[model samples]
Target: MSQKRNIFEEVSDEARDEQAVQPGMIDRGRGGARKAIRAWLMVLFGLVVAMIVVGGLTRLTDSGLSITEWRPVTGALPPMSEAEWQSEFDKYKQIDQWRIQNQWMDLADFKEIYWWEWGHRQLGRLIGVVWALGFFGFMAARKIPTGWTGRLFLLGALGGAQGAIGWWMVASGVTQGEGMTSVASYRLATHLGLAFVILGFIAWYAYMLGRDERDLMQARRAKEAKLFSLSTGLMHFAFLQIIIGAFVAGIDAGRSYTDWPLIGGQLLPPDMSVLDPWWRNLFESPGLVQFIHRCAGYLLFAFGVVVWLRGRQSAHPQTRFAFNAVFAALSLQVVLGITTVVYAAPWHIAIAHQLLAVILWALILRARFLSAYPVATSVRG
Candidate 1:
């Protein structure tokens, strides 16, 4: 027995020596690719932020539905000639917005709105191309895990679905009577809500796969996961708020509630009973939609405050981060919502307000991810 070495143990040792793989094998090549991915993801996130802001602009400027058709493959190629421009306009002419509402509008005016919708579509298209190319490049270069490669692919697929949803949303207005100029409230909300969902998911997934949380302490990880879950819960609330907000925007609801802490100087707003039996009015009445959005804002801010107060004791940088990020963003968003109500939403201010929500949300997600995993550290004797 003393002269014998176990064959299995011998083989294991030989394999270890030959392969030279370490305990940190997963982290190998993760460094460069992770950095690259972070940089690229930051850019993608910025573009999404830009697209959202531009979308707000398109809405405020009343430029949506300018193009009037879904030409996914050919749409990528813009109007190149006068004839093509007229052809596109002719198609738009068939729609209710053009034929009934904007029939008197001239070509130059059409161009003004057309450019906005075109910019929106083109930006979305660019996001798709960049994400796909960067993802594939990283995979081929042996930078990211095959698992992540699959996830990124699915995200790209989501981008594709979003395009279809955008058209579906636009097609709603087209289906309405000849004088209607805007998409259905529900469709509008769906397109906007879905965009935020996809953006949030991408940001969260990036934080999960690419971020290294080794800087955090062990106790913090357990605590942060709970907080992260809470933060995620708040995000769900925020989304509902967005849909309510979209209903307001769709019906020009916020435009009328030009006062804070009250609606038209009243507690419950006058005439909230628009849809007969009262229940349906929440979605149908602009007053009710704005009112509900305001209530949701209060709830969201309150949740953030509670998460921060309860979790401040966790001995983790990210625990503090999780609480603070959500609190700060929630506070700011609440304020912005009020101002948008009071000031009637100046374009630049409104756009900035929306963009900050996205920024704070992504950071809050970072906090969540770090709290869950913490950072790996070596034991020191």
Candidate 2:
């Protein structure tokens, strides 16, 4: 049975035809949107770099444990007066880090470290507010793409978790040791790892979202399989190195064994057994930590070099450059690490070493991301 088409149906069909004839940009409005997203990402990137630097200083000055309490909303504002400062100091004194490790440490010294941790927390709060405001502004403007807002939300969630984790890290020392001041190496590693992951995610997403319209959905999504896997593997290896490096920092291992190429002129430092089960010493013993950091450094350098050469052969200059940057930055990181150790981890060199580690982390993250979607290789030509 054939049905006659009504005027309404005919007009609907015509409307559909008109829509189908619209320009590509009208159909896919990603071009301009991408540029705006990119500008946002650059701003975020700067914030993250600042966070990393402040965090490094926090770690360097042993100020990370200064703020014993975690108050999400109220903590953003620093203590208001002398009374407020004393009140905060009183709370800190109850913590084991004060009663035991830093016993008799005057209020003046306490204020010094407290201020650093306070600034770090305040910056964190500012970042949260800025991101929230910006995200809402973008959403209202309809600038964010579908499938990505959730990821951005995830970043915000991670920031929240980070604050909790920072407290979790501080709590460990408070419970076990008296004013011990030093936190567990593992906790420090976790803190650092989370920070790196969050920063990397922000950077990677920005790079993807900011490309020009003519470039957004081009040929690059093709090789996501192999390059992505390779870059991810390399990043994993680098993270392991970073964790080992933390172990070194935790025990102040650099101040002891400055000799390189071989730890103390031997494959392993002598008397490397203390924690009963032998393996435990690797975590608790300064000598073993130094030994591990040195070995990890070699593997990190080698792994990055291989990735660079391999990326160069893939016909993607960004991929190659990422690897090259990773290799070079890592090499410089090694030199800095050695100098830091040889000089007994002086404040300047120590700070530089930490900064370079941040740079190395950034490079490795770039390699992982660019490899996932190599822009140069996806040319439509």
Candidate 3:
């Protein structure tokens, strides 16, 4: 329909229609269901944290080798009958852990440890399902943001690898004639290290997705590069510490030295040259491993302080707050580490310490993210 136009008419229907049809961020292929994906990731994050804690409990209770088999699918279901329970217990009796340490465990006692390992595996399976559903759901709906499909897929791939690695770690202890009571410390380190890596990726992705792309792009211009670098270094250092901690847990090294500031009241534990191959001492010697963990903890705390000071100098209030949180967590983690050692790494205290590690890891990652993509704030008080 034609409309009467005034002499000063400045716009046309075609022009208005064009303007209305103009693409936005979503139409431009720059966006997705960001908040939805973030929520999904947060769910995965919590599950992964639970997995870590449960894994810790499994190790603490010496229950990691209970299942004795890696049935990714069939393993999801625990024994339903007494016969099935005895069958599972029979497999446990074949392992070195069962022979030397848990020889006294009857069918009833076997069930106790079996449940812990089963719960740990079950949590892992749950995390995988959550990731798969979220990833595939977003993929099928074509809602994943540009350049994010590969990233999301990587998480799932690593998760699969983690399952295989879990089996590998368990297999190390399910040996004959080696007298192995636990998994190889190195394998444990690798498994735990990968978990932290997955966690870091999830956290970083969520942080980026929390804000609008345009805002993130703009924030990139004002990034505190030096602070970001420092935080990056701190993050890597902390990850190394976590891997070493896994070593400590693998061998129950924390119980070797109950005193702080000294090992057996000396600068080093007695008989550092105990292991025959010399290299074996690094992994097999509890005294040496715990010593390394404690020293690394001190160094990590010192470095964390340095990074925090630099973060405090940032102009952005949000960035400063994030770093402050990191420092607080770092301080608390150190104290917890000391207490865990003092208490001989009791399951409760040790799990708390491990839980704090997860918290600290996330906080450090958050601080690093802010340093890289700072949130803008007003100058006015």
| TM-score for each predicted model, relative to the true structure | 0.86, 0.85, 0.94
Lowest lDDT block of 10, candidate 1: 212-221
Q: Please, what's the RMSD in Å of model 2? A: 5.0
C-alpha positional error of residue 9 in candidate 3 after TM-score superposition, expressed in Å: 10
Top of the candidates by lDDT: 3
> Would you give me the overall lDDT of model 2?
0.76
Model 1 Cα lDDT, one tens digit per residue, 161-232: 888988898777874455677888888889888788778877876675455433323434455566667767
Error of 1 at 93 (Å): 2.9
lDDT of 2 by residue, 174-280 (tens): 55344366677788878878888887788778767656544555545646567677778888888788788777777678776877766777878885896789788
In Å, residue 343's CA in model 3 sits off its true spot by 1.0
Which residue pairs collide in model 1, if any? 213-375, 214-375, 214-376
Q: Report, for every candidate in turn, its global Cα lDDT versus the true structure.
A: 0.76, 0.76, 0.92
Better of 1 and 3 by TM-score: 3
lDDT of 3 by residue, 1-381 (tens): 987889798897887898885545543675889999999999999999999999999998988999988899988999999999999999888878888988888888988999999999999999999999999999999999988999999999999999999999999999877999889888999999999999999999999999878888889999999999999999999999999899899888999889978889999888576999998888779999998899999999999999999999999999999999999999999999999999998999999999999999999999999998998888774
The most accurate candidate by TM-score is 3
